[model samples]
Target: MVDLPGFKTFGAASMSDSHLAEVTGVSSNPGQLRGRLYLPPSLQRGAPLVVALHGCTQTAAGYDRGTGWSTLAEREGFALLLPEQARGNNPNGCFNWFTPGDIARCGGEAESIAAMVEAVVAEHSLDRARVFVTGLSAGGAMTAVMLATYPELFAGGAIIGGLPYGRASGVPEALAAMRAPSGNATELAQAVRSASAGYRGSWPSVSVWHGAADHTVAVANMDATTAQWLGVHGLDPAACSTEHGAGWTHRTWRGADGRIAVEERRIAGMGHGVPIDPSGSDRLGVAGPFMLDVALSSTAEIARSWGLVAAAEVRREPAEAPVRRRLVPEVMPANDTAAPPASAATSGVGQVIEDALRAAGLMR
Candidate 1:
């Protein structure tokens, strides 16, 4: 049996609440990356799947503990897939977001993660159509890689403190890009297109989250991220942007089919880290290390923004909800990016478990 040690965190003790979340090994791990699956006790056959990626120096369990993703999966009836970066991949245990070899479509870290996703989808009998991915910092940069390379696989993606895709080919270039101002929106979007020349399918909806005071990654990168997605969706750069809850400046763009393709959250005064909501009402993760409580819950808000939480998932009778759990960012400076129409990110996962069992040669 693996030793599961409990840890404490600020805000609510939500990290401790994840004791019940069981992390299982993937049945057939094709991805060079290590894969872990978080399954709630009340698991269903065709629940939605969420792929959660960790940042630099973070292990899958550490990030989940602080972020409360496993807890959220339990409450929301979703399955969680965490693709962890091995230390050898990067000295800091960061995904190779800056390495050209790692982000390619068919091989390296990105494709390995995709293989992991496919295996988990089969193992859990998950609804493939409902898949979504989210990440923070370096992981966030990798998240952008996933969306661009595997647009046909994910419905939507959330990037927290991440730079634009294909912005850098190495660590030095990554550092420079992270500090640069948001570049031409059209050019930024074109980078994504160039990354995957043949993928012309419906682009995944994007949600951008960045701290206003993030010194590690310049706040301007958020603008570049927003601009990149906006240009992809063909939205006007000067479209009117608006304010949402707690100084969250937001803008959304929709396609001719009436589907919202992109949305961005520019949090005022937030610094480098994943912002957590101190309010127990909506707290999703704990505050530790790169996780900070800054009056708003990025995890909860992003989940809702991703269109995953149904009314029943959040509004079940109080008597029926599980009890216990204590847990769990600065807002970025304001920019003049105007809000477009109020469209938001679209939301997802099923599998033939027995078929997977046979494929893995675990069953005949």
Candidate 2:
């Protein structure tokens, strides 16, 4: 039972309401790892779970605040788990995705994260089969690590502004590849396919999001990553093409493997930030549109395509009726004129959860 430094907890009763809390003693790695849990309006057993990972220099709260995932979770009736990186474990407060030891099975960051997931599931009523993971930058890198190492555990993953891990060729090469700019789509694709082979079950569907102008991660990497998945699934890499939007450009790859599918999104004119919040704070670096939207939509699509959710059931209900509760007061900003500082730096996870709950009308 690891105790966090300044943990807090709060909740509301409406089915559309959300609960905020600084969960401590949740990570098995005491003193080294801790996480913040965002419970949505409904916690009936078997609810979906989405584990949101943060980038370097970003806390769990900061990530939640910057991205507004808790709000989405509340509206969609899912649990959002934000795991914190202890300073002792990661000096920059970033997950050690580049380190071979960290990426290995049941050790380093992987073990700590897996333990956190287990703890959350054991303590809460999370639907084990519907579990998903997504992240940005370094966090995105970690998300890729989880998919490769624990393919059996995750239903799907969304990688934004990040790249795949270098193969067992060696740590130096892997680290270099991880840090290198995105280019050579063929190599990137090969790496993903090779790494994914280690998984015990069917490969999980993946959605990759990258920015065209992302100087940090490089836009080329997106193509390479997508090609790799296409190759592995026996799909034509050349078949993938680009789609332009007013402010974004999306690249997609669609293929079927029994129940799983693969897809990707590349945002144009975007930097190394989440896609949805174009003007997001510098703490997590530059962001484009909300990546959460992409994540949720992709998740929902995969659920339906893979039969995790019945298409008829989701389509039968009207959006208005499904919104059982609304917490309008909680969402209105204290001052509409002033922009809140990016929540990733000064605020705690509790504050992010609160904002999400309020934004979704799940809190008062």
Candidate 3:
């Protein structure tokens, strides 16, 4: 982990470190996932919960620290579940979204994640109806897996620079899936439907985000992702409403219930990272590898859509220590020995920048 030299977590100067409370040890079942939970100072009953997944080569702590989910949770009086992928599972630390076993229901990482969510709900005074999930890259892909496999689990979710679930079974196919094939949107959505059979529940609303210039995961994947959710929600992609953001565009399609079922974001001139707002306004995470200092904040945008925060209203509560406990993995099923998802290897220069961004934050 790089100490970001000269950089402090936004507003860390005035806030006590204890305000960012986290407890390590909750188990991600079936997969025995190593995971942690962030707590807010004041636990309001029925508060919203967010399950955040990190991108490749990033740890749960690294992603939470950089993205400021803990900070947001504390302020908004919500809880967080940040799950980490073990190195043994995938050397690159990317979620195994491409693996068939991992993406399937009641099995592999997907089932384990659902189990983790149950763990969080069991212990806390949370509103099961208000759960949401989001992730970046491979994490983003896994977010799609969780939302699709267990559509009843989430109210909404956001995917940043990710592809549709069930589109690939391995690395080679994953690479090919990024090209956004002819009429790819239609194909991707159908693939999601086939992922789970005989499921008739309200599909989660989706927020799809991708930089127009993202080279790591082609922007085309965003189109396919948008199509996947729109198809699930049965909304016409062409008949959508549009909202403009600084350096980005948001397109939404309201469902029959008069609520947004699908929304897509196109960040202009951005790259392969979660967009961060450098200005004090809308700041959630730090600027580092895969964490860009763009004019928009995906975190803030996502939270508002989830109904966790209000427009122009960001809260910061007093410091409160969190409950801590050690994780105890349940006995694995005999037939399941698959490892958690792994991260993908990127270029040397990209590694340097990512490491430097991490280092800069750490150093401060």
On lDDT, who's better, 2 or 3? 3
Candidate 2 lDDT: 0.57
For residues 194-313, what per-residue lDDT tens digits would candidate 2 score against the true structure? Answer: 555465466667778776656445565566566556655667766665554334444555655434356776543445556542222211211212232221233343334434445632
lDDT of 3 by residue, 1-364 (tens): 3223222222223434433334433464666566678777787888888999987667787788667888888788999998877766775567888788889887788988888887787778689999999999888989999888988889999999887888877655665666552346667777777777767888999999987877657788888888888888778878998766445677899999898889988877776678776465855777666777765678887998888889764332222322111111111123433222113333576564453333211111
Model number with the top TM-score: 3
Q: Top model by lDDT, which number?
A: 3
Model 2 alpha-carbon miss at residue 300, Å: 10
Off by over 4 Å in 1: 1-31, 181-183, 311-364
Per-residue CA lDDT of candidate 1, range 111-189, in tens? 8888877777887899988899999888899999999888888889999988789888764466567678445887888
Stretches of candidate 2 off by over 4 Å are 1-27, 167-175, 178-198, 257-260, 277-364
Question: lDDT score of model 1?
Answer: 0.69
TM-score of every candidate relative to the true structure: 0.77, 0.66, 0.79
| Candidate 3 TM-score to native | 0.79
Which candidate order results from sorting by lDDT in descending order?
A: 3, 1, 2
- Models sorted by TM-score, best on top: 3, 1, 2
Q: After TM-score superposition, what is the CA distance of residue 102 in candidate 2 from its true location, in Å?
A: 0.8
**Which stretch of 10 consecutive residues in model 3 shows the poorest summed lDDT?**
323-332
Better of 1 and 2 by TM-score: 1
Whole-model Cα lDDT of every candidate shown, in order: 0.69, 0.57, 0.72
